[model samples]
Target: MNPMTIHVKQQKHDLALAPSRVVFYEQMQLVETFDDQSQCHMLFFYKQKYLTAVRTTRLKLHSYVACAFKEGTVYESPHPFLQALIETNIPLQKYSYPQLKKKIARPYSRQEQAKILTFFESFIPKKQLFQDMKSLFYQYRREGNMSAAYRVIRVMRDFAPNNRFVKEMANDLSYRKLANLYLEESQTLMERDPLFKEMCASFEDHQRLLEKEGRWIEAYTHQLSHISNQPTSESYQSYRASLSRHFDSDSRTYILEELSQAIPSFQPVTEDLFHNHVVNENVNAVARLYTERELNLNEEQFKQVEALLEENRFNETPENLLPFMKRITAQHPDQTRKLLDAFVIRLLETMELEQVHDFLKAFKKKSSLMRKVERMNEIHEDLDCMQELGELYYGFHQLEKSIECFQMEMELKPSAPEPLRWLSKVYADKKMLDESKAYQQLCVDVQKWA
Candidate 1:
C-alpha cells in the first residue's frame, strides 16, 4: 500500500500564524481531513510561523498537534480543543499554563526575542554575539534570575561548548559545565552524547592551562580528584590511555614530573592505582615512572617493578633509556656502569650463549678485543689476532701459549680449514704425536665437510 500524502495550508497575514489544515487525499478524494484546529495547534506551540499554505499542506499531523497549538492567539483562549491543548502542553513542558505564559512574557522568553536572538547568533559577528550573551547572562545573574542566566548559558553552550567563557563560568560558579550537566541529568544522555564526553575530556587542556599558571598542586589535585570520581568511567579511562600513547615524550616526562611532585610519598594503594588501573596494559608508563624514581625506591620495590616489566617483556627504547642513563651516570658514574653491566649480563643470561657472544661481538667498542679480532678477520691478507699473538709467543718458545692461541682460533672459526691444519702442525712440533694425529684427523674431517 502506498503511504498517504499529507497536505497543509497556512494563513499569510500573520507571521505567527500556522497552517489551516493538513489534508490526506487519494486521487483528489479527501480520504483524511487534519483541519485547522490540529494544524494551528502544531504551528503555535513549535513557534514555526514562517510556514506557507503550500508547506503546511505537505505536513503529517502527529500527537504533538495539541501541544504545538497551546500558545496560539485564538487557540490560547478557553475552548474544549484549547483546554485539551493546554493539558497536552502542560505535561510536555512539565509546567502549568500560567507559568509558561509568565515565562513567555519575559524578554528572553518572547518568541520574537528568541527568533531575533537566534538569527543574530547565527549571522551576526561571533564576537558581538559572544559579548551579547555574556552581558545577558551576567545581567540575569545580577538580577537574581538564575533560570534566565541558565538559558543564556545553554545558548552559549550550543555555540561553543569548549569556550574559555563557558569554562570560566563553570569553574567560578561551580555551575556544572554543559557536559557534566548532561551526564548528571540523564543516563541516556551520558550513553548517547559523544559531544558531552568530548567537552569534558577537553578538561585536560584546562589542566595544562592551570599548570602553566604554576598551580601544580591545584592542577594535580583537580585531575586526581576528577579521575578518582570517575575511576572506571570509560571516557576518563580512554583519555588517560590516549594521553600515554599519543603525548610527546617531553610532555609525558613533564606529566610524570608533576605526578612525582603531586604524590611524593608512595602510598601502596596509590602506587597500585597507577600500576593496575591507570596505566594502560600496552604502554609501560608506570614502569617508566618507577625507573625515573628508582633512587627513591627501595631494593625490593625496584625489583618488583623490574620483574613485572621483564615478565611482560617490556622493552624500553633507546630514546627512553638514554636520558635515564645520562641521569644515573651524572649522579654516580661508577655505580651507573656497574648497574648497566648487571642489566646487560642479565639480558645476555636470558639468551643462548652463542647469541650472547654474537651480540657482544657486534656491540663491542672499537678498542675492545673482539672488535680488533673482527677488523683483522675482515682484512683478507691479515692473519687472525690469535695467530699473530701465537707467533709472538712461539718466538719465545712458549709452546703452551702457542697451542692455546691455535685452539682459540679453531674455536673462533671451527669451519676454517687453515686453523685446524695449523693446530695439527703445532701439536706435531710439540712432540705430542697422538695429539698431532687427533688434530690432523679433525682437520681431515672438517675438510671433507667443507
Candidate 2:
C-alpha cells in the first residue's frame, strides 16, 4: 500500500451566487442545484463522471461578469468569481472550466469515482456501516454473550486480521476468565467440531505422558486441578484410571513435591501407600531425607505426619512411621480415615485380643472421657467403621463397651432400628430391665417414625 497525500484548499466567498451559472464546458451541460443551501458543501467529479472542460472570460466592465459552459448550456454567474481565497495566491475564478482544463486534462472515470465513494462509505455514515455491527456485538456481549461472542469473533476475525482495535475487542481481559469461558463453551464446540475434539485429546495426551513418566502423583494432581477448572466426568475417570495404573512404590518426596506443585492438599491414597510401604520401611532414612531436604508440608501436614507416627510406631527401628503418619494425619480428616482405619486394624491384629482390649481401656481412661466420647460419636456415624469397632469390642466380651457402642450408634442414627434392637438385647442379657424396656420402646418409636 502506498502512502496517500491529501491536498486541502479553502476559500471564503462574500457574494451569494445563483445556481444557474455552474456548467460543464466540455459537454455544454448545465448543472442543476438543489433549492436548499448548505454552509459547507463538497463535490467530487472524476473522469468516469464527466469530461474535461475549458472556460474563457472576456471582461466587459470593472464589475466582472463570467460565462460557464460544460456539456450543454452556457450560464452566467450573478457575483464575481473571486472573493477571498485563502492559503494560496491562486484566484477562485481560476477554478473555472478553462483553468481546470489547463491543469488536468483527464479526470477519473465514473467507475473509479464510484469505487472511491464506496470506500469512503464503508467507514462513513457511521450508523449504517460500523455502528450497527459494533453495537450489536457489544450488546450481545453485555448479555453474557458466550455463543454470540464466539460467532461474532469467528466472523469479524477475517475482517481485521492485524487490526489492534479488533484484537483488543476479541481478547479476554484475563487468562483465568478466558480459561473459564473456554471451559464452559469448548465442550459444545468440541461436540460440534472435530478440530475442537482434537484439541481436547491433545490435553489428555499430556496427562498420559505425565503418567507414563511414573509421575503418578503429579498426573493425578494435574488431572484434579484440570477438572476443578474445567469439569468433565469422563476426563476425571480416565485420569484416575491412568493414575492407578502408573502408581507403584510410594515415594514421599516425589509425592510431596508433586503435591506442592499440583495439589497443596496432597491427600491421596497414593500418598498413604508411599507412607506405609515406603517411608515406614525406614523411618530414619525417611526422617533424614525430610530434614536434610526441604519439606514443603504445611503446618497441617506436619501435624498429620506426627499423628501418623505416634499411632503407627513408625519411630521404631526398621520402620519409622512418624513422619509419614504425621503427614497423613495433617491432611483432611476424611482423607486420613482410610489410612487410620488400616493402621488401627494392623495394630489390633498384631497384638493379642486381651492386649488390645487392655490398651483401649487404658487409652480411653487416659484421654478425656468427653473427648473420647465425641470421637466415638464421630466414628459411630460412619456405619462401616462403627460396625468394625463394635465387632472388635464384642469379640473381647466387653458387654458394657459393646452396649455403649450400640447406644452411640443408635444416638447417631435414630432412623436405623437395628442398633436399638441390639442395644435392648445387650441390656436384657445384663438383666437391666429398665434399660431394656427403654431401648425396646425406642425401637418401637423408631419403627413408627420409619
Candidate 3:
C-alpha cells in the first residue's frame, strides 16, 4: 500500500486568522480531514504509528477526529511529543502543548537530546533540519552541555557531511578557547589533536612566561596544573623535566610532598605519577603506588622492567612480577611464560600440586600455548600438537585461538575426528551454530570412516 501524505494550508490574508486546515491522503485518496496543524504534525512526525492508530479507529470517526485535534493531546502523553515539537523549533521558544506551557521544563539528557536530533533528521526537510540542528548545537554550547554540544556537531556532520561550520566546530574549537570542552568528549583528544600535541599549549605559554619572569615555583605549579588537567604521558614528562631543571633535591622532595598531599581525584594522575616515580628510580615509592592502580608502562618502560627481570634471572618475587606480567603478557609471551615458570617453581616449594594447578589456571596461557604449538610444529612437522593445543585454548575460553588450531589440524589431518569434534564445540560456544552443526556432521563422518 502507498504511504500516507499530509497537506497543510493556512489562511494567508484575513482580518481574523482561521485554524490551519490539514488533510491526510493515502494512495491519492483523502483519508482524513482536520483543521489542526498539530494533527498534521503527528502524521509526519510519528509517521506509521499515528497512521496505524488512525486506520484502526476510522470506524469511530467523530470521536477519533475530535480527540486527535485536541489542543495538547496526541497518541501518547503529550510530554514526549511536546518535547519533540520544542526540538523542532530548535531554540524552543514557547510550548505548543498547553500542559507544558506552565510546568517547569526539565532539560533532556544528552542521550535524549541526541534521539530528538536523530528524529528531526528523519522527517524534517533537509534545509530546515540543518538550520534547526545548527541552532541546537549553539543552544547546547550556551547551556554549557559541551559533551552534548559536540555530539550535536556529529549529528550535523551526519546530515550535511560536507558542512564547513560542522568541520570547524571539531577542528577549530582550540582557537575558540573551547578545547577543554572538546577534551571532555574523550581525553584521548589530548593525544589525537595535533595543535595541543598532548599538552595544553595555553598552559605551556603561561608556564614559559612565568619562568622568564624568574617565578620558578609559580611556573612549576603551572606545569603541575597542566598534568592534572591532561594527565597524558607527554604532560607528565614535561612536569618532571621542569621539576628536575629548577629544583634541588630538598626542594624537589618538598614539592613532591605537597603534590602527594594535594592529589587530584583523577585516575590518570595516579597512573602517570606512578610512571614518574618509576623514571626517578624511586623504587619504594613505585612499590607503594602499586596498591593505588595498575601501571600502564610504555614500550620503553616495559623493556626497562624486562631487562631488570632478566638481570635478576626472572627470580623476582611473584607479587612484584605479577603487575608487569599482566600488562605485557599479550605482547611478550616468552617473558610472560618465564614469569609464570618462575612463579610455579617458587609456589612448588610450599604449595601443593592441586593448589599450583588452580593458580596456574588463573593466568590464562594463550600466547604461550600458541607459541608452544608453533614450536612443536617447527620441530616435529606433525599434526599431533593441534588437537591438544586446540582443546587447551578452548578450555580457557579463547575461541579464536581454538579456531586457529582446529583449522590447522583439520587441514593437516582431514580424517581426524578430534579436530572436527573440537571445532564443532568451539563454534557452538562462539554462537556460530550453523558452522557448529556443519563441523559436527564432519566429525560424525570422520568417526564413521575411522
Candidate 4:
C-alpha cells in the first residue's frame, strides 16, 4: 500500500508550539482516519513496535501523516511518546476515503483503538502489524492467556495485508530488508533484488561483522560469492582489483573476469588482474612444483596435503609414507620436521609394533631417504625420535638395540630420568634382576637429585 506523506512545513510549524518531542525512524506502518462522526485519529508504528495514536481535528491532517524515514515526532504529551491517528491527508490522491472505507474490516466506535486498528489493519502487513499489536495485545492479555492471543490474531489477520517483510521472510528476511532499505524500490525490481551494487555494500558490512567474530571462512565465502555472481559496480572495483585475497584466483582463472567485464567509464579500477599457478593436490606433484619454483604451499595447499594423508594407510603400505617423507624433506626440509613427526606418529599409531621394525627396515632401504636421514640435522638429536625408535625395538624383543638407544639417550644429555627408566625396564625384560634393580635405583637417585 502507498504510505502517507507528512507536510513538513506544517510539522515544522507544529514543532514550535509543541510541549514534547518524540523522534523516531525505521517505520513499520502508518494510517490516518475519520470515524462516521468525522472524529479524526492517526496511528503511527515506529521502530517495529512503537505504536502512537493521537486524536485530532480534521483541519491539520497533513501534519499528522507519515513522512520519510528520518521524520520526527514533536508534540506535548503526558508521558514519553507522541500519539497520533491518521486516515486523512493521504500521501497520494490514489487513496480516497471511499476506497479506504471499502478496505476497512469492521464497525468502529468512538474510543475503540482495538477495533479502529482492526478496521484499517488491511492497509498494513499482517505479520508485522500483528507483531505490533501483539506487543500491545499482550499488555492487555495476561498470564499466558491463549484466548487473548487467539483473539488478537483473529482481529489483525482479517485486515493486515501481506507486507514485504512478512512475504520476503519466507525467502530470506535479512537480504530483503537490507535490499529494500538501501536501494530504491525501482532499482531493486531488476531481477537481482539487491541489484549487485546493494549486495556489495551489504556483503562488505556483513563481512566486517563476521571478521569481528573471527569467522574467516564465512567472510571469505561472501567475498567469493560477490566475485562469483559477477557484480559490475565500481563499489566492488577494489574487490576485483585483488581477486586472490580470499581464494586462489589463480585456481579460478588466469584473468580476473569480473574486472574484464566492468564498464570502463564507471569502474574505479581500469586494469584487469592476471595470476598464474596450479594448486597441486598430489604430494609428489607439489614437491616437483616447489623444485621448479612454479608453486608455493599455503594453508589451503597444506590442508589439501593433510586431507590426502588422512585418506592413505601409512601402516599398511610404507610406499606412500616413505616416499612422501623423502619428497617433503627434499623439497622443503625446514618446513617438514613437524610434518614428519606427525606422519611418523600417525603411522605408528596404526601399525603393530612387530611390523614397525620391518616397516623401518623397508623405509631405510630407500636410498634417497637414507641419504637424507644420514645428512638431515632436523631430527638427529630429537629425543622423542630416539625414544620412539627405542620403543619400536623393545616391542620386537630387540633388547640390545633398545639398550643402545637408552644408552645413547643417557650420553645424548646429562642424566635424563626417561633413559634411566627405560634402561631399568630393558634389564628387567632380559631377566637380569640385579642389573634391573641397579638401574631402577639410579633412576630413583637421578629423580631425587634433579
lDDT tens string, model 3, 260-284? 4355455544655655565555544
Clashes of 2: 38
Q: Among all windows of ten consecutive residues in candidate 1, which has the lowest summed lDDT?
A: 23-32
In order, candidate lDDTs are 0.44, 0.43, 0.48, 0.44
Per-residue lDDT tens digits for candidate 1, residues 337-431, read 44444434343335432443454443323223334334433432334577665554454345676677778878888987776777777788889
lDDT of 2 by residue, 1-450 (tens): 111111223245432222334332211122222223522222222211322221222222211111322222222332111110111122223143334433333343221222222222221342343343454456556887555544444334443346565576667563345435457756665554332243356557756655564434334544655664564547644644554454433323333333334443333423443354334554454454454343455565455554555564532531233344444345344455555444443434454444433444422212232233334445644665654456445544456667767767777776998888877877888899998999899999989988
Report the Cα lDDT for residue 401, model 4. Answer: 69
Number of backbone-clashing residue pairs for each candidate, in the order shown? 8, 38, 0, 18
Query: Residue 188's C-alpha lDDT in candidate 4?
Result: 45
How much does each candidate deviate from the true structure in C-alpha RMSD? 23.0, 32.6, 24.2, 22.0
Question: Stretches of candidate 4 above 4 Å error?
Answer: 1-351, 357-450
* Evaluation by TM-score, superior candidate among 1 and 3: 1
Q: Is candidate 1 or candidate 4 better by TM-score?
A: 1
